[model samples]
Target: MAITSANQLELLQTAEAVAREKMIDPGLVVEAMEESLARAAKSRYGAEMDIRVSIDRKTGKATFTRVRTVVDEEEIENYQAEMTVEQAKQYLEAPEIGDTFVEEIPPVELGRIAAQSAKQVILQKVREAERDRQYEEFKDKAGTIINGLVKREEYGNVIVDIGRGEAVLRRNEKIGRESYRPNDRIRVFIKDVRRETRGPQIFLSRTAPEFMAELFKMEVPEIYDGIIEIKAVARDPGSRAKIAVISYDNSIDPVGACVGMRGSRVQAVVNELQGEKIDIIPWNEDQPTFLVNALQPAEVTKVVLDDEAGKIEVVVPEEQLSLAIGRRGQNVRLASQLTNLDIDIMTEAEESARRQKEFEARTALFQEALDIDEFFAQLLVSEGFANLEEVAYVEIDELLVIDGVDEGTANELQTRAREYLEAAAKAALDAARALGAEDSLIAFEGLTAQMVEALAKDDVKTLEDFATCADWELAGGWTTVDGQRVKDDGVLEPFGVTLEEAQDMVMTARVVLGWVDPEELVAQSEEEAEEGAEEGASEAEA
Candidate 1:
């Protein structure tokens, strides 16, 4: 192949054709051609010579050049490409080190091997440009839905031809054993776009919860218009799904809009999901109320929520137990996911029995600690007294309100309760000391004697050890393992220490030990408060 007048224009024509076919910039193809031609020219000229090629974008004219750089006497390594400053004076009036001298050269007539090598170079560059173009086009399309045609199936994975690129729908991402043949049109959610060495990988999914949300958004005009918002979605893939929605407009019912007139809208989404049943629930700011709505078709007798633990207990009628829990606990599982809380569902009868057991336990505790008779202990338990501390420190009027309890009786009960608590505290402190607990830890505020004993048993016997503990380590927390939340038992958790209280106690210890500056802590807190206030003001203004 020669860069003659006849073939000079052909170079530009071929570059534009390749660029158009690859959907990449024409300048990139031209640059690739220039590089390939330069490589061939180097083969014709000395390999050490710096040969360069340039193509005129407008005139389609090819220009070839030979370049040599002037270097210091000791730096001249390439005899054909580099010359010493003194030797370069023959080619220039004055040539400083690092100065390049360029001379026009005739374009090389590429041999069969050279032409083949140049072709491979151009192809490699074009493929790279194509991959970059594809990546840039689809990166932002992630988290969206796109229509594609199935190309083939490798193992269980299906490859789809999306207009300019091919995406893979992994086996796990398919809904309920969905099988597609070649040319089958499929709707999929672009779950992710990743740029790899080979090319951009567009992962498609039909089982994602967001897939259902996007389907609903496409089907529901109110959701698309932002009048009704999809707050949360939980899906069991092709089995069942729960969607929580809220409506900003009072006149518009979010559930009704999602369900559509005569189930037209929701039916469309259901059909696309291969008959997955959907429960549209109205979103509520209160978690319990929202959970009640989420557990539909079952009557809830009571809902007990432990906000600090992110757990909720739902008591349902015995007849509705199976329905609330669903088949194989699917209903409760989806509800838990929708509400972002751990749910423990029980029958009304079970809840009542548990409550009675708690009452009896509290009554027994009062009888033993206060040295009272069964009847007197029962009376205390019935009046909302759970422990000796409450009975000892409660207002005299609160104890007086109990039946047949006078001022003198209340005084005696307080005295007995306080005496029992002091004895228990003394015993716990003695045990902690026996286990090598230090006085520095014992005198620390906030921690009970029993907490110190618990810490001592766990080998935390000093203030420094206590300060080294993380809040979660001291107050317990939930861990996610294999998609299930597991409970991590904390040392002070049994002592009723909350996570926030544990954090404050640890920070207090650090400050007392001079490990942290109190003034800096105060300044950081104030700065955080100001940032929060500014955010609140901006949101309110918006």
Candidate 2:
């Protein structure tokens, strides 16, 4: 019955006062008024009389308007279509036959039931609006700070008072091992704020990895300046954590800055986090390098990468393995997550054995060539050599001391050794050749023209460049050239280079340049000034 601005304001204030006193949303009370008016209007007028109510926000009041259909009839007073032109003279405008008439019915005219109907309509609309409005106000507040009062603890979950509402702080969200009692004041992060018609569903978490990230941002000034970046973090709440940080400025050591003097900077965060053990490490882009840093306080000797499997194998001294792996592998576990690498820790003894197996395989292959086992034993017995290692690495002069092992035998043994080496090298080169291009040859710098020419041919292209014959071909041994035996002095005195120098060229050529050509006969032939000089000297003597 009261459908005016003044009436709406009074109703709104009344609802606001009620909501404030009870700590409930005022919109809910407004909705109840709207529903009350609707039912009342339906009971007084027919249910077909659609009723609407509007409430003023500034006041605890509302207005209710009743709408009805208009009908034109000769003499019917019900549902009046128009007032006569004579009767409309009260206002400046005169009404026509087809025009509609509108007249304000004062509150005094509406019965008690009609006023009740209006109130119901106003209340229902307010309740619906409250949910939507509340959601908007809180959703943006997620990931922010909030002040809440501990309401009650149901089992272990703590319910909190958030101004006009209550939020649940599940036991897991509580920092450290802290316990909460009813009416205790607590500060919590608005981890998640969700809306339901009943109320908002706020999700609270204290064990998420981001919890540590937020704690650092709160305490560290460097983080706000963009100078420090936390590259990664892994945490086990109330236990231990590992975080990787990097600094844009070289002058600032990222880990050192985060650690602070006597670890004060991180300790602030730790204390807030309730004394969680934290280890800060410098972040590295390189996997091997990053893993080494991640396994800190325990020095690492080597890191083997298996990128496809996303795993790394690290080697530390036997004593440090326990330290690197930590208590029940906690250190390595956190490091793995911090570096995002699956880690397998090993001790030095395991690595040493692996290297030993590799070395023995290579040595056996060397002995197989040139019947080196038998040749070495004979040389050792004659020259008083004890082991194979000495003979294998002996100088040419030392080889000469061994009886029955002349330069010819030495040269043949050396060539066989070179060919065996070439065969072994080809296996490794084959894999590289697949992944390499023509520029692969460009890796060579100090190569000679003769050597490059050998690499140019298809059959000898790669093999010739890798062959170790350059020294002997340039040396004094006479070898059959196309079945034609060509012999010369083995004296390298003319070249002023030793066998060691020749050996160096072969090894370098095979690794850097790929193929090496056999030594070409580079001997310079010179004839005596002839016997004419001798005849003149003889005449002078006579």
Clashing pairs in 1: none
- Compose the digit string of candidate 2's lDDT tens values, residues 1-542: 54455566666777788677655678777767756755664555455544555554565444556643333346435433234545545643644555444433223235776665555565446555655656667788777666788888888888888875667778877766788777787767778888776766876666667777777877778876779988898887778898988999999888888877888889988886678889888888997998898888889988999764456889999989989998877888788878876688888899889766655554554456556674464444445543333444567677776666798876665566556556655654553444332333434554333333334432234433434455654333445576233554422313433445655655666644434333321121112334667778997896
Best by TM-score: 1
Report how far off residue 98 is in candidate 1 (Å): 6.5
lDDT for each residue of candidate 1 in 351-421, tens digit (9 for 90 to 100):
88999999999988998888888998998888888888999999899999988999999999999988999
Each prediction's TM-score versus the true structure: 0.88, 0.54
- Clash counts for the predictions, in order: 0, 37
RMSD of each: 3.5, 25.0
In model 2, how large is the Cα lDDT of residue 530? Answer: 43
| TM-score result, candidate 1 | 0.88
